[model samples]
Target chain A: MRLFDFFKLSRRGPTSADTAKQRLQVLVALDRKGGGGPDFLPLMQKELLEVIRKYVEIEEERVNVDFQAGTGFSTLEVNIELPSETAKMAV
Target chain B: MRLFDFFKLSRRGPTSADTAKQRLQVLVALDRKGGGGPDFLPLMQKELLEVIRKYVEIEEERVNVDFQAGTGFSTLEVNIELPSETAKMAV
Candidate 1:
């Protein structure tokens, strides 16, 4: 049934689902980051830091929000390096 | 030289430049959210709230970090709703 149709689609190499998934992802990313639109990553990072800093004292370098592309995949990594409790108390 | 070469590339349809940009974007987005890898948005949102709560009191629903797919473009939106200073003081 559906499984058979999917298997038939895969004989061409990648399954239809995988290929479709791959194609859709690549198209969307390029348009947003380029396509004459403003890059939102830097903007987002700045605002995020502002909110976090209201309570926590953190160095700018300790906050990282990044989008990394690998092969056919991409990952969004959000990291915050929090200072020790003693450091927070001292401040 | 380059301009003429670019013009030649465009007459066929979308310029190579536009096509490459489009293709790259679509592929990257699909892969990140799918590809059997866990989505990062929910995880990031949860952790983000934990850090923010240390200083300001906020309801869990007030913070949002989301990835949205639209047409050929995708957006990453991070929003945090902060209460008034008076509200913070009351807390």
Candidate 2:
């Protein structure tokens, strides 16, 4: 290693920027490899519907759970549509 | 410039890793400065409640919109509780 390279390493193991870079690298790699944002969504949606059914009567089709990645934030949205009086009393 | 440095620079303006690094740097920098997320959440929540209320009867207090950060993916969670029949028809 050159003197500058040696000095830079000697200063510290890794700066915050380096740590952040490594994390981002891992995230990008995982995303590209078809990873992340899985293994829990469908399960979560099922459980959520079960819980909502306790207090209100709604069909599985009325519940939606979505996970999406934003600029710097990821979003998990749960939208549950309660049945209207007529809809609930239909059957 | 050193021969190795000159060669690396002449190779390309920025590799994918470099671009990833720069993007990660910006994200971290914005996070440290308390600038990563904001400016659209409250508005979104308000609009969401308004839309939901049009079809169903739901109050704003029962809606929760949360923003959080995690290992590599941040999360924005929205949970809304629809009013049960008894509650809606109470008054």
Candidate 3:
């Protein structure tokens, strides 16, 4: 094997950038499939809340679902804040 | 607490949709900051490849850095295919 190839083979695993890239691919693919915004966002959010409710306490404002459309593509962005560990213990 | 509030307090955790939303938010934020296409994409790719090369045997074709600009927003998509476990073992 070439010297550089050997070095490459001995290297560690994926980096944060790799993880980010993989994630972006999935998100972009989903965005493409959904096209602008998924009509089921509210229903999806309701169901999502129900599922999350099983674990930690979160405020409604802590969860957000939004769609951003550019020229040729649109993205669906969701943000949910989890309760802190201390907050969880109090519950 | 109200009946529903009590129930909401006893939830589980974020769902896949929740995760997607969080990830999308970051990606979108990055996209927005980059503004359509980052002029440094080529340089960024070169540096990214160098870093990734330290870990795996990946071809140039396997690493794709693309910008898709829509009407209002743009997305920078990066795709990298690492050497398969079997392929790595063979090396």
Name the best candidate (by lDDT). 1
The DockQ scores of all candidates, in the order shown, are: 0.15, 0.03, 0.02
User: Tens digits of per-residue lDDT for model 2 on B4-29?
Assistant: 23223223465545333211000000
Tens-digit lDDT track of model 1 for B4-90: 222233233655454433121111121222233323333344444443345345555654445654432233344444333312211
RMSD of each: 16.9, 22.7, 21.4
Q: How accurate is candidate 2 locally (lDDT)?
A: 0.30
What's the distance in Å from true for residue B28, model 2? 22
Sort by DockQ, top down from the best: 1, 2, 3
TM, every model: 0.26, 0.24, 0.27
Report fnat in order of the candidates: 0.29, 0.00, 0.00
TM-score, chain A only, candidate 1, equals 0.38
Candidate 2 per-residue lDDT over residues A33-86, each given as its tens digit:
112222222233344334334433555665555554433223333444333321
Alpha-carbon lDDT, every model: 0.33, 0.30, 0.33
> Which candidate, 1 or 2, has the higher TM-score?
1
lDDT of 3: 0.33
- Model 3 regions lying over 4 Å from their true place: A1-91, B1-29, B33-38, B70-74, B86-91
Alpha-carbon error at B23 in model 1, in Å?
19
Ranking by TM-score: 3, 1, 2
